[model samples]
Target chain A: MTTPGLTQVLLAGILVVIAIAVARYWRLPVIKDMAFGSVRGFVQLVAVGYAVRFIFDIESPWLIMLALGIMMTVGAHAASGRVKSVKGSFGTCLAAILTGSLITLATMLVFKIISFDARYIIPLAGMIIGNSMNASALVIDRLASDLRANRLAIETALALGKSWREASQKFHRDAARTGMVAMLNFLKTVGIVALPGAMTGMILAGADPVEAVLLQVIVAYMLLSATTITSVVAVELTIRRFFTRHHQLRIDR
Target chain B: MAVTGSILELCNLTRRVGDGTPARAIVDNFSYSFGFGRLYSIIGPSGAGKSSLLRLLNRLDECTDGSVKFKGSDTREFAPCELRQRLGYLFQTPHLFDRTVRDNIVDAQPHLSESKISRLIQQVQLPSGIVDAPVDNLSVGERQRVALARLLATQPEVALLDEPTAALDPANTEAIERLISSVVTDHGVTVVMVSHSRQQVVRLGGEAILMVDGQLIEHGDAVGLVKNPGTPQGRRYMNGEPQ
Candidate 1:
């Protein structure tokens, strides 16, 4: 199968026009978002595509690491925006995402399942970083809200001589689970509900169906590990903000 | 009524809330000494910082200035969890874990034996069968009793009762009052209860501290303080006069 050219991409513009027309007809408030989102997505993806192509051509490990670092920093910044109510959220997100993505990628490289080549690492890093970013954000947001909402329960536990970790144990589990729920659901209903992006992209690029399935399996496992690590790290960091060294619930933030 | 040596002492305890210029003091320069094997009731109108003072005693909220000494040592010296264990606090609204009554009690003392759990149930005057019952199945009164049992399971030297019966019916209230009295007499647990009801303090019959707007207005024998307050503000409060 041949890659789609600029002419074929121009044809996709008709779909965006149709969506904007429908929004206009319905007088929806999201008309501006829809129109702006189309342009922004186009620009962002095109820029990323060029950047990835340049990184892949370089074939230097340092350049690959630099690209991954940039991706993680941007992902952390985006994740932190979702949890603006918590202090030090950016640092928390950065640490969690970096730890999760790097650990999973390192494991894959060590096992020789994936090579150090940028062609494999760059795209794989993108997927792991993206999933870790979302997981980190969800964990932080849910934990903050749950801790604030259940101050009475938490304080009661602390008053009963429980450590801060023990006092917020329930909330920590809940927040971590909240972050992983999406990935778990995706695992449960991946092919039956919808073919995931990596598998579909592979199939569209004319890879053998069996090979695509195998690669998708690896992607799923990588995500599960990344998200689990990210969620746990996020909870560990975020829970500290709500509590003091004295086991007191300090939600001044 | 003469009491022995103090168990908990608060010296110039103050808690200021807010970050703006001139932060407001919720508990302003409060000082008190609570004796062991005795019950003390803190009576005050709404927003008198009675609850705030209790929180400070437990170190649930930090004091901006001053210190709380448990058994003559600064609270900071002991680990916070260890201090809280020794000084148990019960909230106005009971917060039981979403599990069986037995689990709630066992949460405080995880290694508690079955016989001990049953003993705690009986100590709180709760029905023995309620132990296996889910906390969600229990009424507000039952929940409060379970909470008290949980508080006692920690074997705290002092119990900070923050309106333990606030949500209970008159019958439940009477039962809880009896339990409070028994805990003091039987276990010799020091209790510092915060209550808005003047009559409850009189009925509890111990030392009483009256607070208004973050200041201790008056304190004496409960019945005496309620019947004939020394200060004009205390007298007006007893008379139900608006401030």
Candidate 2:
């Protein structure tokens, strides 16, 4: 298969135009968002493509690490926006995504599953950070809402001599599960229901099917580890915001 | 009513819900002392902060402008969990864990023996078979009993009951009142209960503290306070006037 030219890429504009037209004709409220989102996505991806190309050319470990850091920070910011109800959500998202992405990437390097090359590390880190961001956001959002809604049950347990951790244990487990449910579903239906993005992209780019499958397996494992770590960390961090050192629920914020 | 040694004391204990000039003080400048091994009933109209004061005693809600002392020590001195264990609180609406009655009790006191669990069931006047039943399957009254059992399982020195019988029918209310009496007489637990009904307060027959608009309007013997209130606010409350 040959690489598509810029003209071919611009041809995809027809799909966006069709979507915007349908949205307008239906008088949907999100027509503005759809139009703006299409433009923003196009700009952001094009910018990232250039940045990744430059970083790959450098092949410096320091530069690669810096790029990964930038990606995680941006991802954290985006994730934090999803949970507007939580205070200090940016810090929680950053910590969780950092912990999740770095640990998974470090493990892959140590185990020689992937090298420290910019080509492999950059793409892999992007995948881990993306998944981790979603996990952290989901965990924090669910935990905060659950704690707020069930203040009576939680306070009753706390008043019954249970520690803060014990009082919110069920919500923590539930929030963590909420974060991972999407990933779990993805894993369960990976190839049968839909071919995952990485494998499909690799196959479409003329890679051997067997090799693409092997790489997809690695991506799956990487995402699972990242999402799990991010979810647990997010729960731990987010729950602290709702409790005081005295084990009281602080929901006023 | 006796001026015996006190188990808990509230020194101008106050809680404010919001912030602004003239903040809304739920329990304002409230000072009182509860004696050991006695049931004290707090009667007030709705929004009079009876439950707010009870929550402050256990540090369930922080005091905005005062302090609570338990056993001659500031309540803040104790770890909140340890203090709560020592001073258990039963919410008006009993929130039992989504589990069996036995599990709810055990969760409160993990090392509780089977015999003790059975005794708690008996003490709360719950049927023996109810111990094995799921909490969702129990009636509201039964759930309250289970909550009481759970509170007892903690072995608290003081029990703060926020309208423990508010949602119950007369029979269940009487039964819980009997349990409260037994809790004080048999176990020597200090009880602080919040009730809107003046009759229930008199029937419980303890010291009654009448609060109106977050201030203590009057306090004296429960029967005397109901029969003859010292303040106009208390009298109006007894007359069923809107606060």
Candidate 3:
């Protein structure tokens, strides 16, 4: 299979126009978002494609490390934007995303499943960082909202002599599961429901089907580990914001 | 009333909110000493910091200024978990865990035996066999009773009741009132209840404290204080006038 040229890309842009037209015809409020998002997505992806290709050509370890750092920081910022309930959450999100993605990437490298080459490392790390970002955001948002909504239940436990950790143990499990639910669903319904992105991209690039399947399997495991780690760390940090050192609920903060 | 030392004391306890030039005190400079084995009803109109004061006592909400002493030591000295066990709190609306009635009761004291739980059920006047029933099936009043039983299972030195009967019907209210009286009478636990109803305050027949704008306005015998308040704020509160 040959790579698509600018003409093929121009043809794909027509779908965005069709989506915006449909949204306008239905008087949906998201017409502006659709148009703006399509344009922004195009610009961002093109920029990133050029950047990744540049790094891949150079294959400098420092540039690769710098690229990973930029991706994790941007991912953490995006994740923090989604969790508005907690203040000063950017640091927590950054730490969680860093820990999660780094641990998973290190494990993959240590096992020699993937080389240090930017071609393999950058894309895989991007996947891991992106997924970890989402997991961190979901965990923080769910836990914060759950803690707020269940104030009576949590305070009742505290009033009954339970520690803050004890009072919120159930919510911690709930938020962690919520963070991991997406990966779990992917694992459960992979191939049958839909061919996942990495596997499909590999197949589209003319890789053997079995090899793509194997790589997809590794990606799934990588996401599961990253998401679990991110979720646990996010929960640890977020839950502390709702309770004081005295074990009192400080949801106002 | 017992002449023994106070089990719980509030020393200029205050809780303020907001980040303005002068933060508003939800509970301001409130001080009181609660004796062992007595019922004290804190009375006030809405927004008078009745509930806030109760929360401060249990350290569910931290104090902005001053301190709470549980048995003569500042509450900050003890681990909050251990402190709360000795000062069990019941919220205005009971929040029973979604579990069996017995399970809710045993939550405060996990090792509570079947016989002890039955005694608590009897003490709280809940029907027999209701213990095994899921709390979802119980009415709000019964749930309140279950919450009370759970508080009782801790065997607290002082039980903080924040309008525990506020949501109940008159019959349920009377049942809860009776159980509350028994908590002090039968178990010798000090009771500090926040009440909105003047009639209910009189009915409970203990020491009544009137608070206005987060300050202690007056305190006296429950029946007398409700009948003839000593302060202007107390009078306005008793007469249902906006303070």
Candidate 4:
């Protein structure tokens, strides 16, 4: 397959035009979001493509680490932005994403499955950071909402001598599950339902099919590890905010 | 668990809520002392901080000013879990865990013996067979009884009830009122209940503290306070008129 150029990319713009037209004709509320999102996505991805190219060219260890730090920060900010009820969640998101991505990346490097090179570490870390960011956000959002919604039940438990952790134990499980559910479903339905983006991209880039499949398998496990860690960490941090040192539920907070 | 002096004391208790704008005190400078093995009903209209004061007692909501003393010591000195265990709270609409009634009671006091659990169930006037029944299947009145039994299982020195019978019918209300009275008279648990109904207050008949805008309006015998309030605010509140 030949590499797609600017002309090919311009042709893809037609799809966005069609989507926006349909949204306008239907009088949908998403028209503005659709238009802005499409434009924003193009600009962001283009910027990322250039940045990745530059990072790959440099191949400096310090540069690679710096790039990962920037990516995680941006990812954390975006993740925290999605959650409204939680206060001081940016720190939680940052800590979770950093822990998840670093641990997963370190495992891959230590096992020599992926070398500590920019070409490998940067792309894989990007995937881990992206997924972990989402998982952290989901965990915080779900846990905060669940805690608020079940205030009476939790307070009842607290009033009966249960600690904060004991009172919100069920919610911890639920929020962690919410964070991981998407990845879990993806793992269950990966090959049979649809080819995942990474695998598909590798295949489209003319990599051998079996090699791509193996890489995809590794990617799957990497994501599972990252998201599990991220979800658990997010829950640990988020649940603390809803309770006081005295184990009382701070419902208003 | 012998009867002594005041089991719970509120000293200038206050809770203020709000952001940038002026913080309004929800439970403002309220002071009272609840005696042992007695029933005390906190009577007030809506937003009078009846429930707020109950919350402050158990440290469910932090007091912005003043303190709550449990057994002659500031409540903060004890671990919150221990404090809550000793001072059991029942909400207006009881929230029973999604489990069998027995499990709900056990959840409160894990070490409660089978016979003790049975007695608690009986004390709350719930049918013996209802122990193994799922709380989801029970009526609201039955759930309230289960919650009461759960509170009793803790063997708390003080039972802080927040409108325990607001959701119950007249029959259920009377049944709960009786159970509450028995908790004090028989079990020796000091009951501080928040009741919207003036009639319920008279029926409980221990002491009634009338709160208006988070301040104590007047407090005296439940019968006297409900039947013949001393202050204008108390009189207006008893008559169901705006204060």
lDDT (0 to 1) per candidate: 0.92, 0.92, 0.91, 0.90
Better of 1 and 4 by DockQ: 1
> What TM-score, to 2 decimals, does candidate 3 have?
0.96
Compose the digit string of candidate 1's lDDT tens values, residues A115-153: 999999999999999999999999999999999899899
Q: Write the per-residue lDDT of candidate 4 for residues B1-243, one digit (tens) a residue.
A: 332377888899999998846699999998889988899988888999989899889888889999988878888888989989899899988889888998898888888899998888888888899999988899989988988888888889998999888898999999988888888898788999998888888888999999999999999999998999999998898788999
Best by DockQ: 1
Score chain A of model 4 by TM-score against the reference chain A.
0.95
Task: Compare candidates 1 and 4 on TM-score and give the better one.
Answer: 1
Q: Score the docking of each candidate (DockQ).
A: 0.89, 0.84, 0.88, 0.86
Per-residue lDDT tens digits of candidate 2, residues A28-51?
Answer: 899889989988998989999999
> How displaced is residue A150 in candidate 2, in Å?
1.4
Q: Per-residue lDDT of B175-220 in model 1, one digit per residue for the tens?
A: 9999999989889999999998888998889899999989888899
TM-score of chain A of each: 0.98, 0.96, 0.96, 0.95
- Which ten-residue region of model 1 chain B has the weakest summed lDDT? B1-10
Displacement of the residue A14 alpha carbon in candidate 2, Å:
2.9
| lDDT string, candidate 4, A30-149, tens digits | 988998898899899899899989989988999999999999999999999999669989999999999889999999999999998999998899899999999999999999999999
- Kindly report which residue stretches of model 1 are placed more than 4 angstroms away from their true locations once superposed: B1-4
lDDT at residue A251 of model 3 (Cα atoms): 75
DockQ-best of 3 and 4: 3
- List pairs with backbone clashes in candidate 3: none
Flag the better candidate by DockQ, 2 or 4: 4
